[model samples]
Every structure is written in C-alpha cells, then in structure tokens.
Target chain A: MTKKERPDNRKLDEIRPMKMKAGVIKRADGSAQVEFGLTKVVAAVYGPRQIHPRHQEDATKSVLRCRYNMLPFSVSDRKRQGYDRRSTELAKVITEALEPALFLEEFPKTAIDVDMEIVQADAGTRAAAINAASLAIADAGIPMRDLVTSVAAGRANKELLLDMTKEEEDAEDAVDVPMAMMPRTGKITLLQMDGIVTPQDTEKIICLAEVGCKKIYEAQKKALLEKYGS
Target chain B: MDKEKTIESKTLSAEPAKIVVPGDILKESMDILPGTGTFRENKNIISKVLGIARTDGRVISVTPLSGVYIPQRRDYIIGEISGINFSNWSVDISGPYEANLPISEVNGYIERDADLSRYYAVGDIIFAKVNDISKTKYITLSMKDPKARKLTGGFITELTPSKVPRLIGKAGSMITLIKERTNSFISVGQNGRVWIKGEDDNVALQAIEMIEKYSHTQGLTDKISDMLDKALGKPKEKE
Candidate 1:
C-alpha cells in the first residue's frame, strides 16, 4: 500500500493539469466545468432568485445551498446516484467554503443554489467541486467579495504531496488534507484531515495547499474574465 | 505555474472602461468614490461584481452583464398579470420577487367584489413603473403614470437587463435609431422585456440580437448601424 513516488511523475509540489471554463450550461443561471486531470466536475448556480417555501427565506441576506453529487458512472464501482452520508457532508462543507466569498446580502430573501456534479472521480473531488462552484457563481453574475479556490495536500510514504490522486489516497499512512480558501485574504474556509501527519508537516501541507489554491484561483479568474470577453 | 503577479497599485485613474471580476481593486485612491457594484475597503475601491467598470467623474461603478433584475424605484418595467387579489394584483416582473400592483394604482375605479378580470385579466402585459421596493425585497409597481398602460398587440422578447442602458444608448439614441429604421413602436423595460409593435419587427429583433451579442465590444453603435442599413435594403454606409 506504500508508494515511493508519484504515479504521474509529478513534483512533490505540483498539482495536476487543470482546465476551467465558465458559462458551460445554458439553462442554469450560471455554470462552469472544471477538470483536474481526469477528475471533472460541472457546477451550476441557479439563484439569487426566488426561494420557495417563503419561510425559508433569509431576512438579511441570500441563502446559499450546495449539492454535491457523483453520478452513478462517475466511479469504477458506480456511485449510488443518491444523497448518502458522504455526499451530504461534502455538500455542506463545500457550501461553507463558498459562502464567505459571496456578498449574499445583495439579494435579500432569495436563495443561491450551487450544484456540483462530479462526472469523473480521481480523488480530491471536494476541492475540484469548490473550484468549479466558485467559477459558476461568478459566471452567474452574483456579486461577491472574492472567489474561493481549493486543493488538497497530503502525505504518503513520508513525502508531502500536492493534489493527490486515488493512487496516493489509497497508500498506507496517507494523509489527505483538503483545504479551501479565499486566496486574496488567505482565509481558510475549509480544512479537513483524514490520516496522521506531524504538526510541522501539517503546516507545510497547508502552505502547499495555498500555492495550489492560488493557481486555481488565477485560472478561475481568467475563466470569468474570458466569459465577459475581457 | 506562472509567478504570482501583484497588481501595481499606482496605475493611473480613469484610464478606460475595463472588465473586472469580484475582489478586483478598481481604484486605490481616497478621492475616488465607490459607486454601485463596487465597495471601498481600506482606501481601495474594489469591485463587487464581475462586469465592466465605468467611471463617472470621481465615482466608479460596475455594470453587471448578467443576473436577475433587481427592482428599483422609478425603474420602468414590464410585467404580466399573474394573479388577482381583492386589493391588488400580483404581477410577475421577471425578477426574483413578484411585484404588487395595487388596485388603486390601476386606471379607473370599480365596485368592490366586481369582476377584476373584466378590466385587467390574467396574462395581460402591463408596462409600469416600480413605485417602491421594500426593505424585504418586496416589489411594488405603479401604473398611475401616463406612460404606464396595458400594452396590446405587440411581440415581447427578453434582453439582458443590464444592457438596457446600452440598448437605449446615450440619451435614447440607439433605440431611436432602431425605431426609425424599422418603423416600429419599441418599448424597452428595465427588466429586460422588449415589446415590438409594428408590421415587421424581424429586422428590429435581429438588431437587438446583434447588440446583445456584441455588447461588450467597442464601436458597437457603428456595428449596429451597419447591420440596420443592410437589413433595410440600403447600401452599407461608408465609414
């Protein structure tokens, strides 16, 4: 279960190749698709619009609802295609990660629904979802304070790594540390770890995540600017 | 990966209209006022939306290219009679919230409990003004203005609400040009509803499409004018 080197031959601090595009879905108010190497996710934003069950409306600001789903075929084992405990947890975390970046007060008594569909899973789907969700939110033209970007750093075989794949995630002593942040302020909105790593290594891993997230942030910005033809 | 680039804070103010995304610093001067779609943070005017930044004297604003229409007082809008109540009519103003059109706001008076549908029935188009938007985002529409009335026998199409100003152009020049060329009565709503009342509005519709398509580009007026000329069976005007 131990891997001595990266399966893709990537540097310890290198992230997988990323592809980000905004305004990919026509029906949704805003949509984007992101690919972190083979893992692809499409995120759609559908509000700052009316929220039914008027009782659910927030008086002071807009409410953000996130749904993270993996299609049945997205994984080799075939996901359940239904909301399970794992997807629910991921969706909640993703929502918290993105909420800080938005100016939800701009659209009062409304709901901003973000739906991220994982089309392929090579691990690190949560981070990829956060990256795509922010892009989709920007594309929807909802006002925001900043954009949230995310990535995972982990330790496998005593070596810290950026953007681990399923291979690295399956290794013995693997430590998956996925983080989401508003890069401008360097504020971490999401941080989670699954395996053991030293406090010193955790700090280094976060620094690695910061670098990875910043790169994704730039890509997210470029995609938004391109949509507006800038 | 490319090296992180720091935005030089010393860029000249009022260089030109440029597109910006959220958190982008539109200006870094105290004298510069942050207008709508922008916020001032720690002496820097940062953009709050993803759109084009425009300058008006010392005030800088960002115009969003897309999003739901937010109703404001005095904004001319088009709505539909979706439901009727004893006191007011619920109108769909193509926004996040349905608008209220009080019975008193309508023309003429009718006896209580009378058939309201006899006057302005459901599915009717109303060109009205937003009287007020409550703090809770409840939109109240008024039809008392002389310009406000029930529009009949017209084609309705939607445009990007933010581009309504552009479709109007500087002081109604763009809309005026299209009206004259197509020989149609065009009424544009701030909510992005466009009504065309005329014999042939195909050319006008195409012109609108062209405007929305090239809205972000420069020299748009010229391009629209050229499109109109060719569509109207006239020679393309010399540059």
Candidate 2:
C-alpha cells in the first residue's frame, strides 16, 4: 500500500513554517527577509531613483526591473556563479507579477529595482523570492494597489499538496504548479506549471495554492505593520 | 508627528487613525473620496502605501511613512549644484528628478559664453523655488523670488522628506522654538535639507535629529521643546 503520510507529516493543505520580517537591510530603501521551512531568502528594493542607460527610460512612467539570484552554496550542488537561463527567466516572470500591483506612472523617467537573493533553497525558492520582493517594495514606500502573495502546490503519489518539499517533488509522478495572486482581489498574477496533470488536478491545485497564498498575505501585512512598532 | 493632515475636512468617526499597508481597505462607502496615497475601487477606498491611514470626514487619505522627495510647484527648498551646462545648472534637491536652473531664472543678465560656473559653481547651495515640474520629469527652479538667495557658510543636514512637515510644526511653532533657543538662523527646506547658520548649531542639529527619530510619537513638540531648553541651559518653567 502506498504511504498516506506527507513527507514532513504536515497536513496536505498546509505549507511550511513561514517567517517574514521587513526592513532588514540598513542601506536599502526597503528590504525584507522571509523563511519557508529551511529555505531563506532576502530581497532589497532601491530607487524610483534615476534610471541608467538613457535609452531604457520611458517618458510616461517609471521602469520596473528585477533580478533574481541564488547563492552558489544555496543548493547541495553549488549553483553556477552567474545569471544562467533559469534565473533570467524567473526574473522576467517575477517582474511581470509585481508590475501590475504598482502605480509606476507616478514616477516618470525613473526606475524601481528589486534585487532578490536566495541564501538557502528547499523546494519553493521562486515563490519565496516573490513574497520577499513584494514586502521589500512596500517597505521602500513605493505606492502599489496591493501586495502579491505566492506559493507552490503540486500533486505527488496521486495526492494533491499545498506546498511540496524537495523530497516530495522528487516523487516519480509529481507535478508542480507555482502561483501568485493579489490576495485582496483574488486576482492571479502568476501561474506556471511543470510536469503534466489532469485539468481537474490543475483546478484543484490552483485552489490549494490560493489557500496557501491567503495565509502568506496576512504574514506580509503583519511584517510591514510590525515595522511601525506594534 | 502622525504623518497626517486635516485640512478643511472634519474628523472621521468610524475608524480611528492606524497604521496600514498597501491594499488595506480604509473605508467602504460610495460617498467617501480617496485622496493622496489612497484610491477608490468598487465603492471601497484602499490604501496605496505603508502609512498611517486617516479620514477627514468624507475623504480618506494616507500619509506615507517614507518615500523619495517628489518636487512640487512653488515649494521653496535648498538645493546643491551637481552639474553645470552652458545654458543651465542641474540642482539636486534630493529627489528622483533634477531641477534645471536657467541663467534667466536668476536676477541678472549674463553673456551666453561667459563661463556659467562663475555664477553658480558645482557644490554651491541655494534656496530656490520649484517653478515647474513637467509630466516627463523635467523640473525648473527659479531663484528670482526675493526670499530666494545663495546660502553660504551654513552646513547642510538631511532629514527624511516625509518628516519635514513635523520639523516645521504647526505654522512654524516647532522650528521657531528651536531657532530662538539655539540662536541659529535655521532654514528648513520642504525637500528635507536644513541649513543652520549660527555660532552654535549643535543644539539645533540635535533637536532636528530627535524630530526625525521620534516623529511618529504623540506630544513630540512639547518633548522637543523641553529637550531644547535643557540643551540651551534655560531654566525650566513650571506652571
């Protein structure tokens, strides 16, 4: 008989242990550090300052730029030192996810930059980076319609899961769906899939991800409010 | 000190002032209007930044706790010359955009090729007015106002731009008290730079730092005045 217990003994709908703190970087306009189980990530936001490379300047609104990098020692197998294809792709998607929440038109001809650095990796580094990025920008005081919350959900051993660990992700039939949304409006801003799943499984996985994101959204707001003292 | 304001509107009774983050619903009413750092969506007014949310009767506004200085028209501020070109000089007022001061904005006429740096070299400070801000971030500053002039000798200190209003107090009450006690000629810029030209400005600087640090707390004005009195060695008056 296939085992019914989860890898970490967490409920099927439960995520990892999450902790978030905003304004951790002294020099950044805004910064945040978030941990999901053993995965730790820090994000720093700068600007609405001047945008370099005059050609990149948009006359009507501020440009939003994002960079996502994983530390060489984050994974058991040391990551390659520079921007490979995967980091570049994640950065593009992460920027698109955050852009819709911000009112970039307010600061024309400028650029708001978000740097996400992953110090440790478990299973859902991309989602953690997105959460950290959203908090950092809000901490930087950039006006935004809402904070975006993200999480990964998947199916392993024919059972759906809210957040999968590396062990579960390695399951032979596992399918991962990383998603993000604006918790206030329930509007999905990011959705990506790896491995095949039934259409019904896709819908169920998304619903599971939403539940995870809602809890994370509350954590993001609490982190920001705590910065103001009580 | 609350990072707030109540202009002509009266106080709102429904929700007391509280810290809020982006997307927090401040009010839910069709009659309520969103103002500065707030927006209206589907009969709900939402906050757009991390700040203290306040309601002045039918309007809700949020005063953001921190942000880069965005120049406004007619705001007199202290700026340092960062770059000079043939036609105009670029001034950094600690904002994302640079303000260009054309030679015509100043009082005298000068030859075009007469070396622009002679009049205002890089690193000189001036108290000028923001004359215009274009949609494309082109800023124009004018020094033609009688109150505007070059500020020499005084050193510049920085404060968070959002805290500038608190440092100035209600109709100059807080700043004036500090100036009188320190015997300093203090010029506070809306852009967050304070210029102190006095024999002893240590007391003034300390008081400004306190305001920056403790701007969120209640009853800060009286507390600062007491600190200033103590620093100036003035006898305490108890009534």
Candidate 3:
C-alpha cells in the first residue's frame, strides 16, 4: 500500500522531529527547552517559595501559576511584547494540564511558578510549551505524581496525522486535536479541539496523540536523566 | 496483529536504575509498597515523576536526583531575615515557604515592640531549626539552641537542596574533610544554603563548587579532597 505523503515527506502517522533538554538555565531552580518541528519553547520553574498577596495562599495545596508568552520575533510577523488574549488562554489551559501531575499538597501555601516563552511557533506551540514546562518542573526538583506529555493530532484531506504543523493547521476543513496525557496511567489531562471532526476521527486522533505523547515522554525522561548524569 | 505487536514492543525497560518518568508503571503487584516519588493506582505501581526506581524489602520508591528543596520538620537550616512584624520575623530559608522566627521562639525574652530590630533586623542571617510547620505551610523557626544563632562574617552560597545530603556525605565525612583541610568553619542548611568562613574560605568554596558540579560523579570524596589539596596546597598526610 502506498502511504499518503505530507509536504514534509513524513507519513500520515508520523510526527515532526522533536528534541527536549533540561537544566538549560542556571538561575532558574529548574528549566527546560523543547522543540517540536519548527516550534520551540523554553520553560523555567521558580518557587515553591512564598506566595505573595497573603490571601492567595492555599493552606491545603501549592498554587501553580503559569505564564505562557511568545517572543515578538517568534513568528512571521512581529508579535506584541506582552500577554495577549491567546497567551492568557494558553497559560490557563497549560496550568490546568500540569496541576494534576504535581504533589502540590506537599508544599502548601507556596506557589510553583512556570514561565514558558515560545521562541518559535508552528501550529502545535501549546503542546511544545506544556512539554517544556513539565520538564522544567521536574528539573526544578518539584515532586510530581507524573510528567505530563502532550501532542497534537489532526485530520486533513480526509487523512489523520499524528502531529500537525502550521501549514496543515491552516488548511480548510482541518481538525486539530491537542491532547496531553500522563503516559504511565494513560490518563488524558488536557484535550482541546479546533475545527469540526467526526466522532470516529476524534477517537482516532486521541489514540494517535496518546502514542505520540508516549514518544515525547521518553524524550523528556532522557533529558531529565541526562541532567543528573544517570 | 502488527499494531498489537507494536503496542507490546512499547514496554518499559525494567533494568534497575533506568530512568522513569511520571505515569510510567514501575510494577504491578500488591506485594510492593509505594514509597516517595511513586504512587499506586489500578493495581499498578507507577512513578509520579522523574527518578530511578529503587526497591528495598518489598518497598518500592524513586529517588529523585534533581529538583528544589522541600522543607521538612527538624531540618537545620540557615535563613536570611526578610521582614519583621509585631511578633515574628519572616525568614527566607531558600524554599517556597518563608520561615517565621517568633520573638518567643528565640532564646531570650524579647520585649514587645522594644526595638526588636536589634535582636533580628531584616537581612540578618540566622541558623535555626524547623520548630514546627503548620498545615497552612507557615514555618515556625526556633533559635533557642547553642548552634542556632545569628551567623556573622561568612560568605553564603547555594546548591540544589537535594544535593545537600551528598555534600554532607556519610556521617558528615565530606564536611569533616572539607573543614579539616580548608581550616574553615562551614554550615550547610537543609534548604541548600551554605555559609563559609575562615582563612581557607576560597579553598572551601572551591571544594563546594567541585562537589556541586560533579555531584553525580563517582569517587566524589577523592575528587573533593584532590580539588581541596590543589586549592590549599596541602600535601596529603598518610592516614
């Protein structure tokens, strides 16, 4: 059977090239950089330290604060320098995706702050950002129940792809499904759909994403262990 | 059949010391008890985060090799005074939570609002004990003991809190060697803060950097001693 070829010469089920590195920043308690195809993100973890504005402190669990930003020069056009609507929404979802994996109760009344800056952006920037942030948190030595891994799967031209790029994402009738998972338990932590997709396609997309996330999880684990010389 | 084989081929490498990430199932057995860095669910023992799987007497755990310091009870720590309120001083013990040294927790009776800044003004470094940690994450500190006092005339630096135990070494052997060779007084806090003083301060600091840099390397003790000897120019005396 002849496999349908994507513009990038990848198979329909193939994801783009990816890389993840931990402990990239000396000053941050923990930091990681991740690259998925053309998208690149650097995430730094700071604090378990004191939570300011005393009232915001949670007595039962550590608060997770995430800030997702894009550099002005990251894309074709110069992006704005501060938080925009898209960035805010991305930050909220990213935080929610990571919150469940942490053992926040271990560090009550403190906050684990994650700052993710996208230096490059394709269509799946959010997935790359979450991937980088999880590595940064682990690098920070924060206790977590598991590392969260993410990937974007989509359907284009009546075909399902494991990971979609900016071009594939912009195509009309394209369906993008970004999903994050805890690989060991195979639990989905984050799922969002853009564009219309059939229920069967959604199921296929989710399964493909889970498989892709498992691969990403291996990269994350390798980067973390490399930092410790293990 | 091909897809089924592919899924089966994705099984984790079970070799001991192999790195495991969160959600990776370490085992599936009720005989093994989950320990730190691990959790059990659905009859499977899985790692909660990044670490190496370790088993001792049917108890399984993952020992994290990196990350920040999470404060615990009875940990001796060094902290810098950040703020002073009516009754307690906020201390930065290098963790997520700031420790509070209540005036009452000090060795001497502090007069209420009687120029208490003289006792522990903002920016003073204190060697204290984790007296108690409330559920709200309020860390209460105590300086009533002899070693617990205001530290003065020392250079302070930091390391990953997880590496602090390695720096201290078995039975404090690493610290003892550093002290004897450098002839400097040093105090290591559980929060990853270290204070160094005396004539061999430079030598001591070099040794510490070596330890922090090669923390995961083997023969750390010998490496540290060699680094110290080179820095201090002290010939090794035969034991």
Candidate 4:
C-alpha cells in the first residue's frame, strides 16, 4: 500500500539507535541511563530493608514502590516533581511492571523504591524508563527474575516502526505499543499500547517489540558487565 | 465503503501469521510488524495486545497471565506514613499492603503516657527496622535497635528499589567506600531512605550525589574513593 513514510526511511521493523550506560548515579543502590535516539531516561534503585511505620509492614513480602518522572525540561513543556496525577499513575504502572521480577519475599516487611527520571523525551518515555529501571535494579545488586527490556513500536502511516522518534510520533496517526520483557525466562512483565491497529497489525507489533526488547536487553547486559566487570 | 472494501482486500491478501513469545528475537525476516502481534511457538495466535487487558485497545501493555507473591527480609525500601496511633504509626509500604511501627520503635524513650506528638508526629520521615511479622499480618518495627533509628541530617536521594543492591554493593562495600572517603556516617534504610551525616555538609553532599551517580556500578567502591580523595584533597590514607 502506498503511504507517506518516516523521515529516516527505515523499514517497518527497524529500530532506532540504542545506547545504554549503567552506574550513572553514585548515591543510589543501583542506577542506569539509557538513550533511544534522543529519548533519554535514568533509573535508580533503592531498598529492601525496613518498613518505617510499624503498621504498614507486610508479614509476607517486601514492597516495590516505583516512580516514573520526567524532568521539567524533558518535554516541550516543563513538568514539576511530586504527586502529580501523571507521575502517580506512571509510578503505579512501573511498580506493577517490576513487581514480578523482584524477589520481594526475600526482604519481608521492607520496601524497594525504583525511581525513573526522564531527561529527554522523543518517544517511548515509559518504555525507556522500564528498560533503564531494570538495569538500575541489576546495578543495585537486587536479585531479579530477569532483566526487563522495553521498546515502543507503532503503526505510522500504516508501517510499523520500532523505537519511534518524537517527530514520527507527532506527525503520524500511529498506535504506540510499549513492552517490557525478561531476557532470560522470556516472560513479559509489562505491555502497553495506544491508538488503533487491526488485530493482525497489533500482533505484528508485539512480535517486533519482543525482538527489539531482546536487543535492548543485550545492550543492558553488556553495559552492566562493562561497568561491573564479568 | 470503498475504503472498507480496500482494507478487506488487504486483509485477505495479508500473509497468514502467528504470535511471538516473550523471548523471540524479532528481525526484519520475522513476518510480524514491529507493533503487531505474533504467533506462539506452538502456532497458537498470540497477540501482545496493549493496555491492561485485551479489551482495552486504546491502551497498550503486557501483563502476566498469573503469579504468586512472596516476601523477603532485610530489603531496603521507601515508605510513607498513612496513619498515627497512640502506640504506633501506619505506613503504605507499596506491596499488596501497608506496614506499622510501634511506639517502642522510636529511637528515644517515651514516658509511659507521654505525648506521641513530641516523638513521631504524623508525616515524619524515620528509618526504622522491620523486626518481625506475625502470620496475622502484624508488621513490627523498631528504631531502638542499632540497625533501625531516626535518619537525620543528610541529603535524601531517591532511586528505584531494584537498584538498592548495587548501591550497597557486594556485602556493603559500595556504601563503605563512600563513608570512608567522606568521613560521613551513612545509613541505608531498607525502604529506600538514605541518611548521610558529616561535619562537612559539602563533603557529605558530594558523596551522596556520587553514590547516586554510581550506585549501579560494580567495583565502584575503589573508583569513587579515588575520586573523593582527589576532589576533597584528602590524603589517600585515613588519619
């Protein structure tokens, strides 16, 4: 079918350039920074210790609190920190995404909080945050079921693109699909989509995202090894 | 209706396909589009539909079919106070639940009927220990315990709970590195609250920021210590 294409002229399945670095933050228990083209996010991990208020303690398992935040300058518009509805929602989504991967039961009555800060936004801020947060957790030395890799794929101009850029996302009528997966067990932890696509098209996008997530997962592992050695 | 007819024609012409599993390597050769679904390895049609569930098409997200919950001890965390009682306080610990801290958990003593307000007022940020939990779901906390106490005087940095291990490093090596270098007393709460105190606020602040920067690194202890030595102009050896 004839359709207007993306500026990069990439094929339906091609992903953008991906770069990842771990140990970017010193004070956090674990940290990582990832960039998908222009999209950038930093993730840090803290916790698995004590629950301060005696009442909130869990007798059975540890808790995971996740916060997904975008810097004021991360987007075209400036954003504030703390308790905004968007950040709160993002935090809950991230917490749910990471819950399965973490060994919460290992630290009963405690909680772990993962914070993701988006330094720049092109497209796929949430996906980038998920990928970076997984790396940060590993960097923090938290045991996990596996590393989570995420990517955004979309049907732009009827063509599916892996890792959509800001321009492509803004210019096209596309369905954005973000997914997180465990590199080792090949399990899915989080998946999200927006806009519209035929069931057949959606299936294709998921397949492509999984493939992209694996590639991103490899990059995450490589970065971790490089920073930590072996 | 012409557009509908055209789309129907395209669907018929579209190649018969399958679903992609979690670990499947997606490549151009793969018939699935980047944002589309895939066939399972068993040839079952697996759609990586978006949002919370299959019915929510506008939203795209993947969720576990099912799973179990388990808790571990000694994990770091960040918690918020939800309620305060005469004997204890309640917190939302971000699990399937909330946590509690008894009055005895306060670092200092409270006269039998002393006002609780002087101690841990509502919304106070304290770092305590999770002593134990009853099967009935009672979570016990203690601040008098050496490991649990009031976290005071330090820059508070937040991170993902997953990365806490990397910050502490192998057997607490990472934190030790920062403490020795800056001569700052550091306490890492299980709930993601970190407390650092030192005579020199600048030194303490710098050390905390560095920790935030490198928490995820392996072998970061040495790298950071060396950086601190140079930045602070302190002798490599401790006095």
What is each model's TM-score for chain A? Answer: 0.96, 0.97, 0.97, 0.92
DockQ of each: 0.79, 0.83, 0.57, 0.05
Report chain B TM per candidate: 0.89, 0.90, 0.85, 0.55
TM of each candidate vs. truth: 0.94, 0.93, 0.90, 0.53
> Which of candidates 2 and 3 is the stronger one according to TM-score?
2
User: Which lDDT tens digits does candidate 2 get at residues A154-212?
Assistant: 99888999889888999999999999999999999999999999899899999999989
Q: What is the interface RMSD of each candidate, in Å?
A: 1.2, 0.8, 2.2, 11.9
> Model 4, range A1-230, lDDT digits (tens) per residue?
22444587765566678888877887676788998878899998776545667687776788787888888888887766556887888788878887787666656667777889989998888988988888777666554556678788877766777888878777558788888777656788787888978899899888888888878877876776666344
> How much lDDT does each candidate structure score?
0.86, 0.88, 0.83, 0.63
* Candidate 1 lDDT (Cα, 0 to 1): 0.86
Please name the candidate that would achieve the greatest DockQ relative to the true structure.
Answer: 2
Report model 1's TM-score to 2 decimal places.
Answer: 0.94
| DockQ (model 1, Cα) | 0.79
lDDT score for residue B85 of model 2: 87
What is the descending DockQ order? 2, 1, 3, 4
Model 2 regions lying over 4 Å from their true place:
A1-5, B1-16, B229-239
Alpha-carbon shift of residue B51 in model 2 (angstroms): 0.7
DockQ of 2: 0.83
Instruction: Give me the chain B TM-score of candidate 3.
Output: 0.85
Single out the weakest 10-residue window by summed lDDT for candidate 2 chain A. A1-10
TM-score-best of 1 and 3: 1
Docking class of 3: medium
TM-score of the first chain in candidate 2 relative to the native first chain: 0.97
Worst ten in a row by lDDT for model 2 chain B: B4-13
